[model samples]
Target chain A: MRKIIFLISLAVVSICSVTTLSAQGIQEKSLTLHHGSIKEIHSTLPTCITVANDGSDAIEIVFPANVEPYLEIEIDKRDDILSFDVIDESITHRELNAVLQKNPIRVRMSTAVLSDILNTSDMSITFEDGSVGEWFQVINTGTLFVNGEVLAAKKKIEYYNTGTFTSKIHSYNTTILCLTNTGFLYTNGYTTAKYVEQSSTGIENTDLKVACEKLSISTTGSGVIKYEGTVDDVEIVSTGRAKILTSKLN
Target chain B: MKRLLIFAVSLIVAIAECSAQQSIDELLNREIDSGTTVFKMAVKRDPETGEIIKRVKEFTTTGNKQLAKEFVEAFESERDNVDGWEENRNGGVVQITAVWVNPKRIYTITVAGSALSVFTQTIYREEDKKSK
Candidate 1:
């Protein structure tokens, strides 16, 4: 009887260990936000977030399962629109991966998360008042308007400009490219307008006022680019009636 | 006597140009020995005109703050020899861009933060084109 009991105990221990190991592995969880709902995300720790739009009426957020224990989800109905406040309560340093889809949302991240990377497409994100980061990349077709002070080290913005893109980016290196159709881009700070390549039928009107160390502008469309800044070295290439005006060269 | 005076003036100009070029070469040698070349580009020219347009080369010293400071000081020491010099500071970052122009070419040096960039632009002379 004692020998049989020992074998059963060993089997139970092995099963428990396997279950704990599986739970510690990577897993995912998905949550849905109703259409036109306002979702505000706040993280206590540094987090990397990627946001995109799929034209769905509801907003979907898929996050790593490990972060679920640290998350606090609250929803309230105000003026017929649901508002969600998702707060991260982790105190230790861990990378929280949150991928959001569809609908517009507001995010407020602290300076500890400044080194985090933000990737966005086909959606609108408004940086609250004063937000800083190391890298922010915008690609594909959509509108991105940042009405705040964003101090970053590098930014690469590719705007199809189905809508307007206006931001104040203070970065050491910045590259802006406007492609297809017509749109407006306005920016101010220390800018090195690396290359602005436009198609034949594309019209992108850009106005930039910056203190530039090196300015390189190239355009091949009917776009008008007006620049005002203190420039050290400049190389301008324009064709097809693209108007380029600079305070120093104009 | 007029010919002799002109020859003396030309000799002085040649000596000055040689010394300036030698200093630049020495700085480049030191950079090669101590720093790492992060980026480099050869001189580019217009296809039809064959006129040299631009060349860019950049070097970094990893995270050695002392070596970076030494490079910045060495570049600043050449400010008096260049035609134009401008320095802009934002927070902890410093940017220095200088232009040196001669009868045959234009050179620009830009130092942003710890990286040093050098650009060269060749001036197209009428006599040289005719000879070609």
Candidate 2:
């Protein structure tokens, strides 16, 4: 009975996690990018636990940087898989072939179970194609940040709603970068126009300005924010000074 | 001329160092502009190593069926609310917004030279209701 109940919960969680994988009408159960990569990982993994999805290798569970990762199913089992390692190198998508060869594991897409993936890993790499390849990672909304300023008392922040529904602002000024239905961030200037409320503007997103400093930006509502481009280093420097450059990415 | 050359080299090194100091947002914006649907992005600061790590994942969509509505009058239509809220389809170019859906967390997204960077700040109340 315990095993049966666990299976039922896993099914629900898997349902929420799945989306369309291709245009050929093929439905994949659980997928790890490296488990399917054509380039071989060269067997760098210390140990690989293999589980098959249908007939093909569905998932490759390995830690490229060698770190301890814990998977706790929030809904069903408290712990089903657990391993800890000391990380040394960084994990990148290009190394998928090397890692998967040693850790050819699979994701069990059966039922709904609450699981939060926690890792003590150190590094990740962004590919030239703009895609970030992460190891021992699962995606979910977590926290907010502040840049372009020291992130002190009363920093300016603006929200631009590009999406339709007005973003649901739980509250404002009270949080680090004031989160809503769309995006997250932080600030260090003072401005009253910084409205983080549950309601939203009309179909079009409005540009918000707090401190002439352009402390923060948002898309939780329906608009876009235009500001000078500054890396984190520059953002942490003196405020009020704006930058000018015709910035474009290829 | 000698002094000018030395000053210019120092300035170049400083700028190069700053650019290499890419944050979680810069790396992410780079991926999103290339047509990746960034679902969730997180940052962690290690007290031991003092290294901050940013992690993100992208997924293809099947177009969820959000609660749709109808407008009785043409001008008073709330229909566009659902059609083009998160993504815009202009003939061919599909421009998608990178968003943070977590409550109390504010995310600022910016784009520069083919790269997009997002910084997040969490909102909390002094009285402390929840999500603090």
Candidate 3:
């Protein structure tokens, strides 16, 4: 599993460069979804789906103080995703084929200590600005304009590094490993993260998935998101590195 | 000697961990330019000729269909729109003065000599449309 993930991560690192594209001259198509999150098969539907946190830089969801946020079950269809950077800006979104995008989501996990991140325990989210946080999964990657510079963070990043650079990082409170790519793998009272390969080929794949989950951020004070980047097929979360796999959801 | 070996190994792991960090630029990594919507115009077939024009003449329609209807007016309006509107925005309603069907392409398009093309996409409402 680890081997597969490493290869994928290496590949993702390369593709990450040209991820942003323009939505030029596209005929404006307005969509309306009844719910919050929408999930579908990509082959059947290739509709564009954007997200909005209403009008806030972050979407606020106050779950039970200790309750973790899971995959937003229902896929939402809306004419526009609310742009938070602006007071009242709207974004055009489309319905993504689940197969193409895989299942990217935003989950709320508990927070760990700085020691955990420094220790490289489980997953780690190291930001270019040196701000670190943790999560279980990323929903989408969005542009982060810090101090006036725009950066790209891939969406649905399960595991990755601070991208050859960083000053800030985010780590989660969970032990990091939940379900392995092959079967159920757990991290019991240890900082070390291991992979359980369902098949020999999945060694890297399993490890990468585990790391992604480890590095994922829990949008607690701020909502967690796995954003679709300017380019299709890639999602960004908080302007960070994201390594994804094509395995079916368990 | 053993402690020194452990320290060296630990240093390598730390260096490897640090190497993973990239100068991933998030700021200025925007999706669109100025969040501005762009508009373009083109000419279709000369209605009198009733002959189809080449693909380069106008923008292609997005959906799948074949043998669409031919028209002339769709072009004129778009030309005017391009000359007039300083800016176009998403969700903003712009008229497609000249819209002709590309029978061969099986789609609708903003003909040349027309204004900005306005797509007639549906909006999803929670309640029934009849109620609204």
DockQ of each: 0.02, 0.02, 0.01
Candidate 3 wrongly placed segments (more than 4 Å): A1-22, A34-176, A182-250, B1-132
lDDT of 2 by residue, A131-153 (tens): 11121112212221112211112
Task: Show model 2 residue runs off by greater than 4 Å.
Answer: A1-173, A176-221, A225-250, B1-38, B48-50, B63-132
- How do the residues A1-250 of candidate 3 rate in per-residue lDDT, one tens digit apiece? 5332111111222222222211433222121223232121111111122223232222221111111111112221232122111011232123222221222211211211111111111112222221122323321112111110111222111222221112122221233322211111211111122211111101111222222211222111111112111110111121112222222111
Fnat for candidate 1 (0 to 1): 0.00
Q: What is candidate 3's TM-score against the reference? A: 0.17
> Which docking class does model 3 fall in?
incorrect
For residue B54, give model 2's deviation from the true position in Å. Answer: 5.3
Better of 1 and 3 by TM-score: 1
lDDT per residue for candidate 1 within A151-190, as digits (tens), equals 3334443334434555555532445432343445544444
Candidate 2, after superposition: displacement of residue A235 in Å? 22
Clash pairs, candidate 1, are none
